[model samples]
Target: MSEVREYIAHARSVVIKIGSSALTDLADGLDKARLDRLADAIEARMRAGSDVIVVSSGAIGAGIAPLGLKKRPTDLATKQAAASVGQLALAHAWGTSFARYDRTVGQVLLTADDISNRAHHANAQRTLDRLRSLGAVAVVNENDTVATNEIRFGDNDRLAALVAHLAGADALVLLSDVDGLYDGDPRKVSETGERARFIPEVSGPEDLDGVIAGSGGALGTGGMASKLAAARLSADAGVPVLLASAEQAGQALADASVGTVFAARPERLSARKFWVRHAADARGQIVLDDGAVAAVSRRRRSLLAAGVVGVEGRFSDGDVVELVDTTGRIHARGVVAFDSDDISSMMGAHSEELPADLARPVIHADDLVPL
Candidate 1:
């Protein structure tokens, strides 16, 4: 059940993310041959009755030569300008490539707000669902054209994982230039002439101990670190993720031994809870004492004000806030029961000693999502 082949065989829906270096060239822009091959792999999966969505990167790279830039733009406005020009080329390249297999592709651009906002997340989910039902493949990408530095998803790796959550994908395949996760630097041969050991399976987040992070490719923004982060996010939500090379996409989808696979978590989260865990932008933080941490993490109890030691940031009642430990590790997120100022005065008081209206748990378990 932990094997990638087994998972792919039963995966009815998938999100396939292609990294930039796999497709773009600074001198020539989008690589048509490579894109067509990717489309073929996607088409094969679609033909197998699996709904497929592509979270693509390469917009910035594609703009390099066409706009006569020697390298990637560094400034914000220039970067957005590049993305504005490149998005059209990226979308057309995908559309034309997929057309060879008679597949219809629809572009769906998104920003962080699209998922972080509850109402918007539902709208995005429904749009993807409709596209799948109509046999149209979704070509998803970050809307870099208008995204600001503060609001953008820095790389497509995390974006792909979020898209998997939004689409309820059973499997996520992240394609890069590297073969897969390795115990050491795959490029550096050992003293015994052995290459880095390729890790075929990671059962949980803790298993990622010895894996080294690689730098982004010349035309890409993500490295091994980002891909692993993406895998963890999707796996946490019960969707297995495959980390493989772009060359092995078809084989990977067919369940061949081609990449490292992250096992899906045993706990499947509800859609809203998943959103709260990953998408919600916390307006504030509530620092919990050891006793409160034990009560919430172990006892699964609501957060009473008696355990609150500190509060940071100004936020209103009902806003989402992070629940952190004394060491600042975020353990949960929940809708607060009272304003930050009100909660500050109520800290350390016994529940029964507080005013009747404030005698409740500061955050109810029903509204809390563990991180």
Candidate 2:
């Protein structure tokens, strides 16, 4: 409990995420009392001199009952329609509740593409920073109405992590229906079930080996898997995360370990590197020779053509590609300097042998990001 409290006490800026299950009822349009409870808790935090940003997930759920739908919509069109209608109501309810504390709320809707694009990412960071600086709590959500399959955030859990990274938040709190990550499903009630445990440290991916995956409530898309993924991502960026039940939200923020606490690391990656390493999809692989590997891994230099061994997949220049070693393990990712066709021709060639106009390294070391 002190561990959880110590974590929250140290966080100067926080990103608090409330899932649909926390803010809505099965048949109600929106749970106003629950929203007020959450708002009041956040207001207390703000009064304590901490900056808070709320990444809320309930637009579609809020619209479901109001639109006379029995359950969450199945198709994307209806989901988008629901989001369009529900977002206004969601913002209104939040605003009304926040007013009790004399706190202003600002809305920020983002799509996955917005963060993936460098320019848009900068714009988002600037906007959120300004809003927080002005003493307003930024209520963020995915722009579900305008997002397509290609542009969707998929889950708000991931969005919260991304927002924490974007906002340079001190910590991230993910409020869900469940208490926290369990060794196995607590519902199993087995003789050896570790129903509740605090994850104080995450050394690597193996730390998440025995975690369980489960679905969300009828109105949400993010489940335990997405929340864990968010934990890993945000933790990697040096932002600690608290995963707790919505029922215990106030306690969760009060230093109570109501859920699993993922400790943040000290060597956090830069925002660009974090987004590049985790968020971007690699379009191809560039296998490097030993010399290039040493240059990159040891000297932190851009990949030179003399170190190229092979190229895989169809990729255009400026697209993200994986840098692999002889063992076929990805060591880094970066924007490729040449198209796949050009790289194929340039492989195994000396710098002078390449055309003068194409003399640059295959993937400059400065642009490369180690995985």
Candidate 3:
């Protein structure tokens, strides 16, 4: 067995993500008892000197009762309306709970733009870092009030994973209603009437093939599949993750192997790469031929106009764009060097024949990330 306690013993920074189902009572909403339990555990871990950042989800669930809604709203406008009201209640519960232990909690709400835009991404990172520096527990949540369905992070799990990378956390704990991933749906009784087999650890993608994840809860958007996706994403960024029940928050935060654990990658990705891989939103795509695809993926070469056969979307220079092959497979994502108009005219042209300024590669190797 892996020594879970030992790993937590050495971790300098940790991220604890509490799901909406964990924090709210479906009927009553904003369950203080559960929130208190979570806060107490997190405060203990934070007091021990590890920088702790929390990605919490509960606003919409908490809003249900106060708004007199029968269930979670399905429409974007109603959902946003609930978020605007419930966020305050959710923050209060967290703040008051932490206050009991003399720890301050800061609420930082983020929209997709906060993580997808280059400048906003950095600013968000700096804000969280500063919050940790001041010995305050930073409580983060999606800005559901203003986010559109097209751009919103559908689940907090993905947001938590991205935040773990942005905050440079060593470990991530996803506290949910379910304890861990299982070979079969735990809720479904087997022919022998036995619970599904538990999956203690997942080394990589192949281990997840047989695992079937269920849908999201009535109170939240994330389910087992989303948590697994989040875990893998964080792992790729070199942050190990624990998927455990909220009841096991204390054990999970202490690094005990209470739930499924996904191992981190051998090497950590650079901050820029992590952003490019997880957070950057591509504004357009540049379709490349077979040769161009091989050049970028195998040879690690910059994308030049000569290799470009077509472009999609209208974007200015410095915007993030995708490099795709004739098959429409995205080979890489990078910041375009030329405006869409300039690139359109430059396509299929030799490098030397182009104007001196336009001679530069359309997407430099340093700016490109092979998917």
Candidate 4:
């Protein structure tokens, strides 16, 4: 526990994610008071020399009241409409709250493509890095208005975990309505009327064996399950995670023992590799022979066309693809150098036997991440 606190205390860069339930009221719209309080906590961290990036989720919830909606929208079109209306209000609230501390908050909205596409991923990283270098706080959120159902992140908790890696954060803090994770739903009493057990620390998946995650709140998309998943993702990426209530933001940011802290994994993957393994959306699949799987996953070699037995989906060159074995087990993921049709034609042909134009490695080792 002390080690976790120390890790958080010394973190130079942090990503704090505030959930929709923490930042909005179902009856009202954006909660200015809550936003201001969160800004105060974030500003304090910045003032203490820790760079902070906020991944907030409240655009749709904030739009509910203004759009004359009695409840959270269920339909994609209605949700998008709410997000469109709420984003402005959400941004303005953040901007106004941070202005109190003479801090500048830059709004950065992104869709799933921004993280999955290599070029867009690089651009987003550069933009967030530049914002931090300029001493401005980046208030990030999913581009809800323009994001379709197919491309949505589904929940900001997952988005926040990915953002932590994208921003090169040292720590991640997830603030929501619940104070912390428990062995059971803390809101519910047991049959014997006993309170749920609070889990103060989670070192790995084994610790979550019997834990129960309740459904999401009326105004939010993510529940405790999503938070745990996000925490594990960030922790595995070498970023310590703290899950606490928004009301305890100050204490949590101060490294106080007020939340459930997820210890960071000892082994860390490079940002690019981690992105490839977890964030990049696989557009297609390339089925490889047993020899190919061994060469790629065991020997850590580049994928050769001769080893490919089949190609699936209509992916273009330079798109992310899964390298699977004959039995459908994914061995690796990489950016294919050829289009699906091109690969299909080149399958089972040795490099030397192929035309000069098609002789190169199918997926270079540098672009491949072993799963």
Candidate 5:
């Protein structure tokens, strides 16, 4: 059907995430040849007028053996240190591989903090967009060295989804060790068994429940479940996802039905709503007056100084917050213009009665990514 080709033929921008198992050797170091093949495939796609951003996972895995460790380190500090060393190695490998096609490569390392904060998210997107515009491939990875437990991407699968949303990517390809999602753990079942059937549609989380093929292998951080979750997120953003083996990278890009393709939702969320509902985590809440609620919920206008009634929790400017009406039901999620304390003071004050300096928006419509 045209629906399948529709995504592939029109995917001007895409996010391709390769797992550690695809990029490195569990026993030794980076797999340069496989890396080269992947880069070549990306180059091929670029030649076809697609802007590709690569989210890779291999830093800690590549650093494992060289640091005299037997396997992935358990201690956070050691893992961070190893990632610092391995990141250089990983970047260099990608750079060298990409250069073979006479193409330039740019390295981008991001943490969860980058997307959680509005400013950092904007800057990160701008940088990646600029790099792609300059005819360079932007190779991204998690900032494992500086990322702590609370701020780390946790796994690159989720990072790829966030990047897809940030880059406005049309599709997200998650390449892993397995071919695709199966009915059960394919590794435990015979190849000719019922589990070999590829799943074509996953309507909801229930469709994926107990459908894991395998957990994360020794070298990778993500398992089959994480990839499925990433697919769901991307699909919800109106961007379909492809879960396939790294070996089928080229075919997947060509839109071949060689793997599982998670269908996108028929309806797409508005950009701001998508950002607020999916990308940014809510930090606080702002209760609005009846008129203000009507303006935002129905008219979709910016929140002004007049409508605020109450504030809950501490939040900074540009942080996403829940917008609740008088009855205590959340009407939307938006960014707050003023901090919690400032909003508390601005509450119930009309624009004309407020001090000249305090008359600005309590929550700017543009700043608010309404959910």
Candidate 6:
């Protein structure tokens, strides 16, 4: 507990993710009072000399009442329409709330492409850095208005985790409906007649075994499973995470003992490696022979064409692909150096035996991230 408090005290920057269940309702839309309270809490953190970024989820839910929809739309197109309308209202509400304290808020909407593509990812990092430097709280959300199913983040919880890495945050606070993680579903009593127990900390993946993740609320897409996934993602990147109820936003931000804290891993992956391992969408798969698997996964060597067994899916040079063993287990993710067709033709041939243009590594070690 002392260590957790120390970690929170030393965190210079943090990302706060507020879910839809905490921000809106199916019929009432955005809750002005709740937004104000949250804004006030964020402002307090800023006044305390810590940089803060908010990854908010409520665009579609906030649009429900305005669009006369009785519930969340199941179709992609209608959901996108609602997001477009609600995005404006959501941003305005945030802007208006922060205005009370004379704090400026900047809205940043992102699609999956924005975070996965190298160039776009760099651009986003620059924008976020500049916003922080200028003392503005960046309000980020998934760009559901224009995102297709293929490029959507699916939920803001995942987006927040990715953003924590992108923004180089020291901590991430996930504000949801539940107070914290529990050993069992908090809504039900166990056969032993005992209620679920609140977990103060999660040290590793093993802590989650046997834990039941309850379903999400009517207005939110993410349940406990998504929150845990997000926490692990950020924790792996060396950012600690706190999961708490929205009602306790102030305590959570203050690093009080009010939520579950996920410990950060000691070894942090490089930004590029982390991106490849978690963010880049695999466009294809390169199946390797046994020898190739050992070399790439164990020795961390560049993938050579001599041990290539097969190629699955069509992908261009420089696209992200999965490096898998012949048995279909993925060993790594890498940026391939050749087109799928070219790789197909070069497989099983040594580099020295190939033409000068095709003699290089199929995937450079620097571009590979072992899973």
TM-score of each: 0.95, 0.89, 0.95, 0.91, 0.80, 0.96
* lDDT per residue (tens digit) for residues 160-225 in model 2: 999999999989999988887775666766576545343544556777776667766688999888
Over 1-371, each residue of candidate 1 has an lDDT whose tens digit, in order, gives 45655876569999999999888888888898998888888888788888999999999888887999988888888888888888999999998888887778899999988988889899999999999998888999999888888887768999999999899888899998988999788889989998888888899656878677776777888899889888898888888888999988788877646788888888778887887788877899999999998887777789999999999999998789999999999888988989999999999999889999999999999888876
Clashes of each: 0, 3, 0, 0, 1, 0
Better of 1 and 5 by lDDT: 1
The model with the greater TM-score, 1 or 5, is: 1
Q: Poorest 10 consecutive residues of model 4 by lDDT? A: 1-10
Residue 174 error, candidate 1, Å: 0.6
- Candidates in order have lDDT scores of 0.87, 0.85, 0.88, 0.91, 0.83, 0.91
> Tell me, what's the RMSD of every candidate?
1.7, 2.8, 1.7, 2.4, 4.6, 1.5
Q: Which 10 consecutive residues of model 2 have the lowest summed lDDT?
A: 193-202
Off by over 4 Å in 4: 189-196, 349-360
Considering summed lDDT, which 10 consecutive residues are worst modelled in model 3? 1-10
lDDT of 3: 0.88
Off by over 4 Å in 3: 1-5, 190-195
Distance from true location, Cα of 120 in model 4, Å: 2.4
Question: What tens digits encode model 4's per-residue C-alpha lDDT throughout 307-345?
Answer: 999998999998889999999999899988999999999
